[model samples]
Target chain A: MATVAGHPETPLIEPVDRGEGLGHSIVRALSHAPLTILLAFIGVMWLVPTLGLFFTSLLPASVISSEGWWTIFSTPSNATLENYRNIFSDEAITSALLTTVWISIGSTILPIIVAALAAYAFAWMDFPGRDWLFIGVIAMIVVPIQMALIPIFSLYDRVHLFDTLAGLILFHTAFGLPLAIFLLRNFFVGIPGELLEAARIDGASEIRIFTRLILPLSWPAIASLAIFQFLWTWNDLIVALSLARSTQPITVAIFTQLRQFGANIEIIAPAAFLSLTIPLVVFFAFQRYFVQGLLAGSVK
Target chain B: MTDSSITAEPPNQGAPPTADEAGADPGRRRRFLVALGFLAPALVFLGVWIVYPTVYTVVRSFYDRSGDAFVGLDNYGTLFTTDILLTAIRNNAIWVLVVPAVVTAIGLVFGVLTERIRWSVAFKTAVFMPMAISMFAAGVIWHIMYTQDPSQGTINAAVRVVSDAVNPPGVLSGAAPSGDDLRGSAAQGYRLQGELKAGEVAHLGLTRIPASEVKDGVQAVVPATVEGGITGVVWRDFKPGGGGTAGEVEDGEVGIPGVTLRLTDASGAEVATATSGADGVFTFPDVGDASYRLGIASETFRESYGGVSWLGPRLITPAIIIAYIWVWAGFAMVVIAAGLAAIPRDVLEAARTDGATEWQVFRRVTAPLLAPVLSVVFITMIINVLKVFDIVLSVAPPSVQDDANVIALAMWRTSFGGVNDFGLGSAIAVFLFLLVIPVLLLNVRRFRREA
Candidate 1:
């Protein structure tokens, strides 16, 4: 909160400075108008293609092939939900959705449980070689999953984790741990020491102190990190592509179908919407926690 | 509170042990055990999944395709020698050089612009929407935009819409004459049959322009000509009929309008030139009553504004990279905006009050202040781009996948994607790892410094 910002404080009438009087809202708007316009353009530029995709998916497939999504505005009656119907009926996509949901949820739960414990230990426990160990774990964040891909493929083949949902959960958990541990440990380190001290005075064990004292205080951080981990694992394609066989995540299924035949707009458009909507919904629902988690790591 | 905790000694600091804390020294060992227990699961996964595989890949890079034979350095050799892999390496090099800076720059722009804006939250949310979708999904959306057909592709359709109004394409799209009456020479399309009498009507049947593309029921206007001038009707001679005479225009056939034909004498000397009318009829003015051949000018038949070949081999890499930017530029914006939010308003305000323009403030003050966050974003993007796989694989069509291949996708293809050459895959994995190490070390150093 005390981080130095690049803009200077200006003399402004705070709302509370003059109760029932004018606030700084209008003055602030006038001052920041140009920058707001720039940001507005950038935001629209970013969203237009996605908006096009969404609108295009809503229109009937026959309309989609011959006209741009922009045409829907001119001829509003042409839109339909047939694309969604097509996607929902596909057996392959449904199974892929199930696999993706299980993988995302599994990856999220496993990492949070394991990372919370490890992060608590790293933050509070006076363990031998803790810095070296924590540093090593943090360093793994930079080692991309690609480096381990080929060998892991062979390893999965040997161990029978190949083509299994458990295999994906395990891989996602391992990758998720570094950031989870880093973010959680940093958050855990900042907890008021008096809470732990009071628990200690009550003759509580370390487990009791951690569970009773730290976990409740760490919920906001934990929630945000979970959203991040879940979003990543859910939207992942490379890991699923490398590790899974027989049962594939939705991303990989979309990839294979699009690659094999990209011509099917009714299928690809709706399948894409189905794939993106889940994470986007998860994202919007937890917007505060997501931003809190992102800023927690960066605000340092 | 944190400062107090860091400075204040614990209540039990002076005592070795109390009744409730008996064997506290041995408890150090117990604490270590507890820490070890907590850390075990993650370590096990990391060791099996990351550390061991990394070392194995490094060693496996030395072997041959099957991983059974011990062929030291040959896999590494093939990385340099193989055409596809070398192209992959070269393409990865381009990707590494380009994508990170571009994404980070955009992120920086949005981040700084939204700093003082009232609607920054909504703007940031909108920009970050792409970050929610998988790169595969982004690729799908862009595949729709980059389709070869203009009617289906959003980008090309937009281009066609805008370009058609401002710069309408010339008539007579690269169509040519067909049949025995007029045959093409190396220089001109469809030279006149045998020899030409001065006043004979020349009928040159053409193909390449289908009957449906031509305008129907258009009357031919043959301009009046003086003595010894050539007159011709160069319409789309073929009809919608399943079969027809080769060089004769039938009912409902339309003219190949705006075509220009030339008169060449026996010695190939230039004569007069006349452009075809809107209805494919043309007349050259007075000539000295000499025999001449009317040949179609190649320029007359050539078409302009063929839509951009987004999936062609030449443009495939950049096209896919555009899709990548469409997805990731938003990611960059969101992350950098987080960093931007942490910037105090005082510095930028001071810079602006000191009479610096907005652009100057951005470049000198704001950019320098954002260096830490910008570096973090840049380094992370560099690492991500080095291992880029899914976008390239999904976005680039099979015809041009080799051109758009990055090391990570290349590695997949070499090993599990039909080629099944683990050694080559391992080498690529190792190569990618080595390439990422410097920036990874830079990032680790930054994080450590921040910590």
Candidate 2:
């Protein structure tokens, strides 16, 4: 995910002015139509490779190699539900789904709760080193996560958090917080001061105001951040591979299933589809707020 | 309910009370503790998981593999010379150089192009769908698509269809001469030893190709040689039961078409070259009476229309980057699209009315304006590519995984798994962190400038 500045400077793209004669302008309009078709064509071309695999994954592996995947269009019965069924019947795959769900939920929720507090402080509270501390937190965004894995992994062993779901949850939370705070604090600061002022006048404690006012009103921001964290932790492989060992999450599970020659489509296609499809569904469903979270980072 | 409840005041708008002035020592201490309390969990996690470990890595990098004896900078030095690490660095340079610029450029185009289209939402959603897939899964998909076998890999299959149409299929590997009767070296293919007359036909047989694999269905036809012409059959020499003589043409052996025959003079100087036909026979007609030795050129062994080896040690990094670009270009597009949406139309119209063409407007107006979004996307991609691990791990075959390794993956494999060389891994980690500083600094500088 990246961000766009919402600065007052207007974006620089526009349809060309066409004040010429009607014949010339008709030429422009017809030209515009082709351009539209060209863009759409490029979009579909961009999509076809992934689309090809998706389609192939639906067919039996026997059918996949014999004929072109596109041949299935003419011969519709070639597709099968076997791969998706195999994912559930297989013991390793089914449990990986559970692990991924548990980790995604834990990793998303804890950081938001923790970062909400930190964000509120950064947004509103007066404290020594607030700017520097907030800057320090956000600066960690640039540090490659590899820098922390080994030492912290050993540290986790000493603390007995290694190879545990809780360890990875904490790991995601640590890594997730800085970006969450940066995003959430930006949102929290933009809330009208008068609304908070009124609550303060009503004798609301800091905790009460945070829960009653900030938390309730900041749902969109929180939701956006939650979806992002969920997708990230859900799709993560390196962390889960390096840490947690009892059972695999889908990311690592699919990775481990890979053979030396190539992937097993029966497992990878459906498994990947299952892994990719869920968050995409989540993303599209909550997309209104999702873009808000995305834009928050750079708009400031 | 109470005056005490009202004591936790918001920042007073009129004249904010200084920590010491209006609030006595106890009150100031209370505010400090509350702020610390709010920050505690975040601080604790960041400390244990990120800060402390980062500091630990830096310290450990100076020590030996067990992190016991101090061997200052030795790990770092090892990183420079280690083949995999150096390759990782070089590959990352490729990633840094190629992926971001290409992704940003494509995204910039998509952002601009989609602006003119009506189905922008559907288009963007389609493009950005790959972001939902993990790099591991993406690796699986792309790996399948890049399969070397035409039956399995979509890319190679398409290439096969196109190349088969446009060019003749020269046998790619698996076909070679099988006998001591094949008298030529690897540099030159075999020739008939006992042949006396130039007008006679001599047969040259190869053994590796199955009869069914010959390019055309027609049977091999040996033609009578013209004056000074040398004609021979290059067919697979072996038969299934070992009944066929060594280096002699046997049934069920396929002809190796497209083998070049070089006829050299007795002085071993000038020679003529002629390629075989579909039936493994070639003719070289000449004028002079000097006897010439016939030899097979090396090109016959090569696979005709063979697709490039995308997963080979050299190309694996670029292949993975193509996958990475497919996954992220849409993301860049969406971010830039948002930036594009922020642009005011008036200036664009003004430029248009002032006689600037569409290309000029795009280059001068849209591009310059979208630089911030582009830079942000580029920097983020730089950050991402530096830490790329999953695809390299998942996509590269275990045999060549070392060849395709990135810094992050190298760090993992070096320290743990089997190596247990935490010192070297930490050094790599530290090396990666240093590599990231320039982008981080660039991002920080941009943020400060904007702030």
Candidate 3:
């Protein structure tokens, strides 16, 4: 009945009849026909636009200009892979795709590592002003990235990190930390204290306990954080738009093409489709953690 | 360590701690240092990227454009006064008022509806697919859909088809009457100046007919007089290269087909109507023997309906908002769906068993239960909307970019899009920060309570 995987104790809707005959089941199904139709209608409305764009991307540019995308159904032979081929072959597009990959990886991994360590300290270790420090970091979550842009722009310019991939990655990692730490620390605090105490009695150092015990135990939280951070960096445009001039990501690349070419669908459609495909693949692959992370981050 | 402490000191004598006690202080200090070490990297990042920049921006907002001179509150004053910036603020207000509410409502409906359907998984996946894509890609998709050309734009094509079926457009929309015989405006029907009897013939000529609009097999022919009614010919009077006499049907000139002629008496009441034939010859055979004025129907000369200008200045902000909703509604749905799944089923079953109608259950029980999730969606959307940049940049045409600007886009433009006014840009940025603070506080408070 489409229950949340994380909350298996509660189903969205209880089934009215579990052991009913076929006729009774049929009647129950018939009663929900209106709702089924409404949901189907909404589903179609959501799918058609993306489907139209996908079909448009497949068709030859000449056909796209002369006929509506819906016409692809009647004449499916007109579709081609030339647009995708062209974009893949283009140097700018390939470079941008590479940039996006490396940036996402760097941004995702750097923040996870840093935040995991900080989260471990906040959760287990006793330090002076630890609670206050954690709260201070959490409060920084509200600072809009706009609040950082001008100064960082100047900072990057002075440090020669302005248009570099590293600069973008660093910016993403820094911004990604607050929520990452919050999520991971919350998860870390749930672990039993005896596990760490036993390891400490066996003479495990703080670093060893962190690397061996805490990191291994908190995989679920870390996985979700990883996926969340990866998607954030992957889909980001504004930060890349502002800071990275030469080392542009796919989002920035597509945006620039849209502005410069002005609805040059052949270049834009395939490139944009490719840009979104990676995240969709990742999202579906790790769909469980994605949802878990979403709920953990927000519905607390 | 406890045994050493117990054995080294007598319980009755309140003496100073033994050597082991003194050693424990350094151990505690070492643990503190170790914790600091673990936190050091993140602390550096937070301080450098977020903390330092936030302070710098607030301070920079008070300085002049060059940053050398201190100009207190001047940039903030200019932000309120400037037309472009004000438009940005207005658009942002519109966005905040519209996007979060609409998106959340759609999300709520989808979330609830999917629960009743068997193929709920497929429905959710379809709706939630857009969330995986970047806003730039979504913007491009909608931008293509909103193109001005009907053949290219899916939306305009659909609109044109529906509108055309409901009220067919005029064929000779831009055609104008030639000579002094027609004596009325384009909005009102053009009427022949002279009165005509049943047997009389009238020749109406039109100019400015586009060559592309003239249909094939339309030939200019002189109307044959019928027995009881007047006859007329409406044709393209001016031939190519301008050789034809005005108000006359010349050879090689095409007929203005589909022109509806209204026959009105001296009292201005319509008597009969006739549409011109393919050859531009129209005859009203049933008109009585009376003086009448032959007028072309105004509907015949009205402009054909093109689809709406979706990216025009008037609709650009709304158009962009629609795209924003398309990209974000899925997120709201997924979050709310999670919230829905977390709701206990027995409460709903109990409410249903008590004879509560579905609407009542939804309005009274379900909605209140989903309030926290809904607010989560709403506030998240508000924060996202305030920072909206990519969709606006991609979807809005350059000519109307200013018309669709929000504060985030305005800030980017002021600082980086060749303006280089960092001081003013910082002020806008800080102003955005100020606007976000209350929402931020609410979120933090919620997080704290939950923790």
Candidate 4:
């Protein structure tokens, strides 16, 4: 075992620097400062608006109108949780929130899975028309979503998917798959081809190689895709407005307040803030993945 | 490592079944299936939604309001001749020219500036914060700011402060004082007693005091007998290098101060004022295709700069510059940041060994490598700017929307806004699509090459 570890031949490894003690600490700290600040700024910027909205949601409707949310800190003694209570108490908002959760989760999971499989084939599986197929997919990004809305609405109406959650899910999944595959395919292409080829030589099937080698190797890409898909679908109002019936998403639900004449800032500020809560959480949880994903297609 | 590994993996593992020995071709079969699977979903979605609607919009432009009967190029003809659509087109041109240029300009500048700042991330995120809030949401914010009549609105209140300051007691109560008061004042300074009364003739100085002396919004406040207090105060809007002739007041009564008019002698000599009605409507009476000076004013205060000044507010230029700045700065910042991060440390060490200054290393070595990212950023920003719809749509009011709209907004109005004329809408949409096809092609080409 010792001989195996030492292997006097030692594979002629390249000498690596492991700078020591205080020098190492200083270098490490200096190297990380830009990223730390970059990340911290992204965090705080994201937090304030979302937090403002959340705080607004917790206060009574009357107070939000008369004063700015910043005033809450100066007069913390007069806070109330009635706005959130009202959201839950009201059947419309609660139902919409649940509807949003279901649609966002379902849409995100479906596209990530499908896009992963498709990306794997494009990246590794050698088939004719693969390049052409990928180009066709990339071309979809140029198709203005506005042009698609009425047509999709008409198509869904005919198919009786017009008012269903399945309809909205299908639309989001379909639109999201192009960019998803485009991004993930690039990431997958970067994977050391030797790893997958090695797995195949060991008697592993294509499916096994995909599940074991490719999918796990592509976790960062997949995580990023999932978060983006989740955020996009959650924030989506256009499709939901055109497709969803009374079973509205949180975005559509908040928009309804936009129409309530002389609409109180209390409801809007809180509702908009509350709506962003899940996205903020998802973003923070996967900040590293999100940043990696953002840099994926552009830099490489 | 490669060939031996392939051999170590038995042929039975990854090797295709030797059915090819039985005269069956695997490549052909795989190609057929791959094409079918890869293209099936995208084709279905895109064909139904994108291709069909795009084709539909082109076809619809031929029909009338009902879209039932074919009337070829009548819509185009109407678009050319009709005053309203012409106004809409003019406005849209203003929008297209201004919004993208302004947003991209602002975005790029800010994007670059913030990179040098200590708390750049904070500032970048602050400016980029509006991007996260959907356009409609931003509209809500701006809508509150621009809400008219409610002195509480940000812009209206700011305007009122200037209005009160300029006019002193009563600004809008009585009609504007005639040009005679201005001429009479110059005469008074010259010690000439000239009683200028209504319907009375008086000789006045024509010294041609260069107009620069009168600043825009610099109003004359005079004491009045009535409760409204300020009366008969003339508004001298200073315009320089306009080449616009002095206003000739039309036969009709002036609606507002500083409005453009066409004054003609009884023998019908022509004179045109550069200023327009409160509606910003300029008359081109008998002026036989000559250049003219126009002075326009806005009391609107930009949020970035507090208070207000009625500087030379060109009808379209300022708006374009503003929108361009807002969008591009953030894009440049993100791409430059990425480019900076990707610089390999060993390359910097090599530069250091060569005795290069840090500035030299950055300029000579770092910037060259960032070229690829910079091109991608520039191309993408151009495309994004070209397709800009939301900022233009939200910033301008509906009344002015028709006149100050972009192609994207015009397309929306034709299709969905009250008229519901799908055919014309489709035509406009298709035209917009054609405008962007080159950008899209470049984007795809870049994606393929860069990716």
Candidate 5:
């Protein structure tokens, strides 16, 4: 009988001729040893710093410097919420946080909606220069932000968009549309055309067909795109820094603290940890859809 | 869930052949509307931010600072000839060369290796954490790590601690105390150079001088004539204040008007002094194996004695590559892992039963089967890398970034980094638009082939 170690049903559990095959098993074990060590080393090197950041974020500032963050298990009483409290206490920080939230939400929703609609057009709707137009949109992806900054800034300034939040959101949405459209269009195309045709036969218009049929079936993709767009916007510092010239985002606000804080690991450790929380939350909520969204165009 | 009925006959009969054909006309109208709707906001935004300013920058680059007069490539000519501009270009080139290759190689190797682990998710998340942090934040973090002092820096402290335990004189702090003769007969002369310093640590010939005595120290070093072979105390001295045997030089060796030179030997012994001529030439005797220090007094750039410029929080291409690899490798791994899972066990069993080697079977069968996955990964990476901006902007040199920068960083710099030069910025953006089109076309063609 075969009995897999993890999955009991799959492993071969034959005990026949154990002594005869002993040398082969040992050799096999030796060969696999290197792989095991490599994996462990890679995992530890990658995870420790992040884990340290996470642990340090939870502890008091004084504890972060004097002791390793791993020592939190020994002194549970050293933990404090002061860093986060300070983060929110500042008007600038809180406003920046609010600005970030708004920007992330707006940028994510707007781009996804626009991209999905455009994706639908490119995917299913037959039009003249359909391929060419999409190619144009996709081409926009390579228009590096550097080439556009001064022009964008001056344009924004001319139109009085210097430091406004609305300006930043618009700028992000413009740049974000190309990639979002590319991703969602591929996913929308993967959906069986019969599903949309089936809906249309029952007297639903193209818009209705999209709203009820394509949108629901493409929820997984939409979720994934939402995550990507949201995170991209949330983690964005340059575009926000440039376009949001007046209003600061979390990235900028955190940066100002760094200049003043110097080696105050208490503030920086916690702040660094706190800064990532939103993205992590977004990831946890949308990760299930990531696989589905990713597989949409690849499988069929 | 929809109220749509299952039809015995398909809806394609009365329509324009099939769905692909049915919407040929209506689809065109719909697409026109949709593209118009989609492009409207983007064009408006891009027009203002990308198109307008970029075009403006090209125009501005040709103009003076006030931008009132036409100067016909004078600005670009100036940029080439100016010493500062030359240095800036060199630094930028170094950044371009070092950053991308290192970052990409590390990323690709790690991405492949980490995929085999059971706990790959955790491993990837950790590495990708830097991606989530803004470039500015990453810059700050790296700055702290690269900090000169060990007490305040994690990297330096670790180096010092390891070196101290092993070699004794501390690796990072100062000379490893090779116990070699530094102050013997070999140390007959020294130079009076200064830089950003930490606590007391013995280096080759560097010395700490009090801030109050700098003026007098310069005076004591100057000699009557800075003749060649002017050996130790072989040269007489004078001060500019007393107007002694020292010549009434117009300016110091560095050529700056107010700045004076105080040359010292390799052992911190003051040797001679000279000021710049009217043409801004300050001459001093050449010394062997001696380090020279420069002090600047300029109107454009302001600093006390020594301060580094362009230490802004920005990633060059290499850092971007490293950061991007961290961010996207997880994505690539997960996709590849899923594709691997999808391969049926019977295929492997069939290969094993046929006496085929595992490597051969995997290569011929698994790799070929993973073609779709490979295409997807390649396309995504290409797209992602094309749009990368934050990493570069957050780590690039601060003072001299211009249109000659990367496409994305230039876009941001021109718009908001003051002096908003849009026309030229837009022209470059148009070029960027040209560059990305082929990649996007390739993606569309790949999907079209699949379809």
Candidate 6:
């Protein structure tokens, strides 16, 4: 037995050797049983409400009205894929799904592109009033979307962008740029100055250096930024709700169903689940980068 | 000229160049141009979408609803005076007061507790899953959870089960007085029309209860005479085919069990209380042979234990705040967990080795170390909750939306949601911006210090 004798007074037990049998592991686990149980209990509290909603979505309208969704545990045969099938077949839901995809992609890509260029400028290239300009972007990060709604509503009306997907995407992109630039600039600043200096010494133009040296090196930051922007845009309701009426995203579409006294819950359930699925998939797939971006974006 | 000067510079860039040799003015101008080229698109966006509109909204706030006439301070006056907007401000105050502190506390607990557990990964994944979903989906989830009907709502169903287990509902929930002998309504407790003395037998009749609702093992019977007290037979008065005499308990009718009868004096002060047994016979024994009114307790006839109206006007703000916490607590936890991971473990071990208990170590060592991260989470949540629009719109029914309204929702409602008053909306928008200025300054100062 490898006796790990570092801190005898520590309440939490240390991990035993890998070669130790399952019995040892079980004993170690049981040593911290109270904390483990508490964590598991909290975790279940967080997950049960979502699980309940998910089970409710699989139930039929009549069954939903007659009994609690927990009853499905006793009668597992009551579950069906009918709600999913119905929502997929509905024109409004399908179109909103398509709109959400388009908006998310446009909103994500445009901000990353614009913010990357600007971040490069702020980080490496020297310009007049550069610090002040970057601070201005930082300040706008806290400007409430409410501040922009009235004036921009009028602007969109004049420019004929009202109720268009392009208009909504533009709005998301603009609000997204401040944080994107801030995060990417912080990351871009950390890249070795010698690399950019060497490229400049090689007679590479600014655009050439930006494309070949800067962007290739900043993919981690860009990846994280992309995921954050995509999630934000996909989950947005205020921007889409204000700017785009005819081209409503899945969020707004589901919101419409909710407004009708929770009518057509069969539709709202599956549609909300469907709307949530894409972001979840993207999030889990790139969770590492997403967390990295979040930590870097928030803390100094 | 600046473009040409960049090409004219010597290739000896690594060696420190003198001021004249560095192409001082033109090279500087060229660098400025190149930086401008890179920054142009972002600057244009920031100006148009944020800067221009922010300034315009401030100016528009001073104007009238149509934005033509200059009605300085009137819209601001209306914001402080209007009932709906005032409610919105109050609700926003409630949100700011409650949400950030609760979220930070929960996050700190989750982050610290999961550090030593093997199942920490799975627990965190479960908690953080809500952050990935849109607020609309969360609203939908909570909307169903908060439904008034126990059968349809999971929360209500759970509440009903617990309440029913603790204190069961009475059998007279839907039962009402059948004859003219009972005189009061359910809001006021029902009473006998005439006073009764000890040893008198009062016949109490109830109707409108379904047969299926009556509890098992209860049987209707005539009350036996009891000494020194009023005796009553509370029974279902209606017969199945309506052939029984009015106000009389027939063979088919059953006893209404669990009905509480109150004995009150002529001055309406309650003297004694007694509950009916399985045979519907209730006796208020030990009465002092004084004349008293025989009455039914209002609680006996009250509605069955339905769950709370979580989304009603009184609870809507708190209910929506809970929903907001559900979505954002994971974000806070993830961030705080990262901060927790960054804390040096030796300090904790050292404290433990120095005879500090776990609670003392946590209170003195851990909490101070986690303060910066906690403040970051708190500030971020304050900003997030200040602009809470979507969850309010999605979860609250339209009838009570005004009751649950916040400042951002008020801004949207005033400008876009049918009211179309641009000036007041602009005033609200500016007020919201002003509210965020302090937090924004704090964040900027932190960033500047870090840079």
In the range A1-300, model 4's lDDT, one tens digit per residue, is 101011122122223343344533443454456655764654464345334555555567666555445556888865787776666787877788899899999899987777777776777665556677777777766655556554565568799988899889878887787788777776777677677767766968666777888888878778877877887788777678766667698777766776566665566555666666677577656655655555554311
Candidate 1 residues lying further than 4 Å off, grouped into runs, are: A1-42, A55-78, A261-263, A295-300, B1-23, B115-122, B161-167, B172-304, B447-451
In the range B234-316, model 6's lDDT, one tens digit per residue, is 88887778788878867877777778899999888989999887768888887876789888888786665687899899999
Worst 10-residue lDDT window, candidate 6 chain A: A1-10
- Colliding residue pairs in candidate 3: none
Per-candidate interface DockQ score: 0.32, 0.34, 0.36, 0.11, 0.18, 0.33
How would you encode candidate 2's per-residue C-alpha lDDT over A1-300 as one tens digit per residue? 122232344444455555464544543664577877877787787787778777877888787756556777888888888888888899888899989999999999999999999988877777778777876776787778888888877887899988888998989899998888877776787677778778877978789989999999989789888988998899898888887776589988877777525447678778877877778788878876666565554321
* Full-model lDDT, candidate 6: 0.81
Shift in Å, residue B211, candidate 3? 7.6
- Tens-place lDDT digits, model 4, residues B122-183: 66555544433444444444444443442224444556667766644311211212334232
Instruction: Report how far residue B236 has shifted in candidate 5, in Å.
Output: 45
Candidate 1 local lDDT, B369-439, one digit each (tens): 56666766776678778878877877788778888878888888888788988888888888888887786
lDDT of 2 by residue, B1-451 (tens): 1011110112222122232446677877787888898999889988888889989989999999876799988998999998878988888888889988999899888887788778889888888878766788788778777777776677778788898777655453555556554565544445646533477676776656655666562445556677876677766566667676765555655556667676777776647888777767778776367676666666555455667688888788888888889888877888888878866677777777776566667677777777766877777787888888888877787878888988888898997657879899999999999988886666555434333
What 10-residue stretch in candidate 5 chain B is worst by lDDT?
Answer: B1-10
Pairs of residues clashing in candidate 6:
none
| Docking quality tier of model 3 | acceptable
Better of 2 and 4 by DockQ: 2
Query: Which segments of candidate 2 are over 4 A away from where they belong?
Result: A1-34, A63-68, A259-263, A298-300, B1-22, B170-304, B442-451
Give candidate 2's root-mean-square deviation (CA, Å).
7.7
Lowest summed lDDT window (length 10), candidate 3 chain B: B1-10
State which docking tier applies to candidate 4: incorrect
Expressed as tens digits, the lDDT of each residue in B1-451 for candidate 3 is 1011100111222111222334577798887799899999999999999999999999999999889999999999999999999999999999999998999999998887777777888888888878777787888888888988787788888888888878887776676788888878778878999999988888988888888777653778997788888998988887887777887787888887888899999999999999987788899996887899898998787665567899999999989998889888888888888777766677777766765556656765677667767887887788889888888988898889989999999999999888989999999999999988887666555444433
- TM-score, first chain, each model: 0.86, 0.87, 0.89, 0.79, 0.79, 0.88
Two-way DockQ contest, 4 vs 5, winner = 5
lDDT against true structure, model 5: 0.52
